[model samples]
Target: MPDGLILPIANQKDYIRAALEAGKHVLSEKPVAKNLEEAHELITCDTETDWRKNPVHQGGFLLDGGVHYVAGLRRLLESQPSSKVCRLSSFTTLLQSHLPPVDTINAILKLESGVSGTYQQSVGTSLTGSEWTVGYEHGVVSVAGSKVVVTVAGNTEVNIIEDERTGVPPVVRIWAEAIAAGITVKDLEPEEALADLEVLELMLRSGESDGLSMSCQYQHIVSNPN
Candidate 1:
């Protein structure tokens, strides 16, 4: 047996328990569960070590597969080893030909750091779409699929670059280096992932609560790690 499987399951607790019982880690796709509590219940881990204090929280669609943007912001504010912090001032959802759940996720993210972002993902295909821009202290970094463009302060023209398997290989390389160094690396620890889920849950709640701005305060996963 493969220790664990990634097929869809109705219950989050059962799914996570099965993976843990088989002594395997899981990388599940989006729409994890009915709610944040169920999502937390699914992920089981040892609490003695307190891995939540780990220095890194990797996230961002371009940077870390959109896993831990909030943690990255925290690291950036603390002047940790990473790129400069950028403010996501305004985000717009140009396309809305998607499910109500997708629209629900578009709201409810208000960072204390003044970084605002919007989830504009859509299921319907479109020939023309809005591009994503990340503004930093030094300059701006923009990416559309494989095409990458960077505009710096001193530089006059935008610089462009491309490479096959660009983002995927870098992620794989990082994992390999960590493992080779005898470091047991978990992809976005259970607690950290749960925190992110809590935020997503807040987003859903905002939609359900008639656009009431909400604060995500659920720390259950960190407190009661399975």
Candidate 2:
């Protein structure tokens, strides 16, 4: 293992363990493990409770704090009625022919007392952009990258936000600066990161079950490593 590794490849937990065992620190890809148990095993082995020693990040959403995008999709649904996701049906498919593997997954969320909504992700289709929308009986709200749109009562409003992710320096520099400051990044804390992995694992399990619905609840990992 290299002294400071930035691993974006799959088998993320394995690489982290190997790097730590070889006296190296690593920043690995997000959803740090295929599931929560593996993440726990890695955290237990770290022993110092140092977060930077094994941080996790999603590729493009590195600075965007995207864990909330998956686990907390229910919060967005709250705009409709129910804030809890009772169950969800999901399926992943191979859509990108040249890129080689399956890159799209669509999930339909069933809310307890609100309008059911869909969460679809595609790699090479026309729906390649990142946009989130919430629909209610009275109005609709949508966010697309840096822009937000709302329509209700025969009136429409638009707002634009600065895209902080577009102009950041390389991650290596950010990592170095944060390390020098001696603090855990609030966005990647155990609570947020672990919940992201947990939701994702449940999604994959749902897909593997051939669209059988999967259930989830927001959870945090309580740890006192070393």
Candidate 3:
């Protein structure tokens, strides 16, 4: 029997539940489920088996790809216990005719820590660049491609990460080591992944309701102090 399973997004809950019953640890790909309800089911029980164009895939590329951005944003914010996103309002639309349902999203997220930020993503845009920025009480940090810039007290510092690899490598390494050692990696926990999905899903839901504010239900409180 295999030790773990890396699953696709479609009908993921069934597959995950089956694998767990078979005594196999699972490392599923992002967008853990189609919506909040399905994701919740996985916590009590539990992809492609092209989320991109499939309406059945919920947010299409948004949920399939947007989860990563949500996760990254959370990490960059250094979210504390109960500091997860609590409410959000978003507007979603399609700029490209080819991308079905929607392709662009602009959202304002309010966290439990009383901090708020904006999120924007679009697969249909002609523009070709990506950046994540977080403002602190004394400084601001911004990441563009492999470069990270920090500004504080009228001073600025820039650092370029030479490696081009994304987070996949280290994530896989940790999963492998955890399986070998009979332990669980907190960062890889299903709840953590669920929180990522919840944020994205809430944004989509808010978009559907014409940017009505949506509250989050499954924001996980980080156990370890940062």
> Of the candidates shown, which would achieve the greatest TM-score relative to the real structure?
3
Candidates' C-alpha lDDT: 0.44, 0.59, 0.79
CA deviation > 4 Å runs, candidate 2: 1-4, 14-29, 43-86, 97-101, 112-115, 166-186, 217-226
Write the residue-wise lDDT of candidate 3 on 1-226 in tens digits. 4455555677778887677565555777887788878876776563221211121677779888889988888877654765678899999998888887889999999988787889999998887778998888899989998899999997999999886367777787898887787566677877788889988988888898999999987776443221
Q: Which candidate leads in lDDT? A: 3
Q: Model 1: per-residue lDDT, tens digit, 1-226?
A: 2243554434445665555555544444433444566665665342222332231111112112222334333323333322222222222222354322232124424444565555433333344443556677898766564455778886735545556544445545655565457454444345555655555445445555566666555432233322
- Alpha carbon lDDT of residue 138, candidate 2? 86
Which of the two, 1 or 3, has more TM-score?
3
Ranked by TM-score from best down, the candidates are: 3, 2, 1
Question: Better model by lDDT, 1 or 2?
Answer: 2
| lDDT of candidate 2 over 116-182, digit per residue (tens) | 7787766547755678988767898898877899999768999997655652234445655555675
Answer with 2 or 3, whichever has the higher lDDT: 3
- TM-scores for all candidates: the values are 0.56, 0.65, 0.86
Sort every candidate by lDDT, greatest first: 3, 2, 1
